[model samples]
Target: MTDQLPPQPTTPPPPAEPPAEPLVAPTAELAKRQLTPLAAGVLGLAIGAAVVGGAWLVTATTGPSEPATFTLKGTFALTDSVYTDPGDDSCRGSADSGYDDIAEGTSVTVYGAEGDVIATGSLGQSNSDETGTACTYKIAVPDVPSGEKFYKVEVSHRGTVQLTAEEAENGELAASLG
Candidate 1:
């Protein structure tokens, strides 16, 4: 058997295609514009202004803030009847007499809801005694923060005097305070 090779025919190539339009239009003017430092800064400022303006507009549409006020026209007083023991060097170690002399001008403080010092006043000499006798302290807590739904009144004497919730809420000054 003889193996014979067959001749292949050559065909002409297809025509060249026309070039398609560019995806993006060429901006020769923009390409030529070199951003100076000053121009770049101005552009940045304009963009920043737009962002800030948008934020301001959003907040303005949200409306006003809530009111934070409390009605506190009343006066509160503090009274203590505590005595101080004077240590003695004598046989029984009992001293003469000692009084819890809460100073006449001792400062009083009222705490608010957040434990902030909301109001301050003094326990007057006319109200308390240096001789250890039970006395009434009148304090004009001009105003109490609405935040402080309740109040805790504190005074410093020979020791600290703090009024309980029951005492602070009492409208009657003398009995509740004392």
Candidate 2:
């Protein structure tokens, strides 16, 4: 029997509760936690300075911005090739007009026949002011070789010159052949 059912109220369920708001830090607390403007600025400056200095150091130490290349250009024969110190195995040779393009503070090594380091010296300045164009390298050569000693010059910053009979025959002591 279709008994009169109690009035069934078709009401939509209550709307779902909205998600709770996340608990954000209080403004005062956030302000205290963050770095101050002055502090942040200082930190940025320090970081920038460090980067610049590091780059400069790397370039200065590792980069190859050589000033010049020395060349022995002239007609001069090496006659007296002896060591600055006779006791020492260093050798020294004289050329007429040679040319060399040596940096201010580089060192050069001269090798004699059989690959013996006959002389070594720093590219020193000629004048007291350290601004002269010409540099005389008083090298200490190793004891002269036995025969037809072939000599060669090398540097950490520039070119190498293999002592030759014809080229060493005559010329100006090259500014490069320091």
TM-score of each: 0.36, 0.27
**Reference-based lDDT, each prediction:** 0.51, 0.47
Candidate 2, residues 100-148, lDDT tens digits: the string is: 2333345666565566775565543322112222234433323333233
lDDT of 1 by residue, 1-178 (tens): 5587676668777879989978876799569878999999999999999999999999998979654543222333333444333452111111233323343455667775556787777655343345544344445555444444566556653323344444454433332344
- What's the lDDT of the predicted structure labeled candidate 1? 0.51
Model 2 stretches with alpha carbons more than 4 Å out: 1-102, 126-148, 165-178
RMSD of each: 15.0, 15.7
TM-score: which candidate is best?
1
Backbone Cα, N, C clashes tallied per candidate = 0, 39
Candidate 1, superposed: residue stretches over 4 Å from native = 1-28, 45-100, 109-121, 124-138, 141-144, 157-178
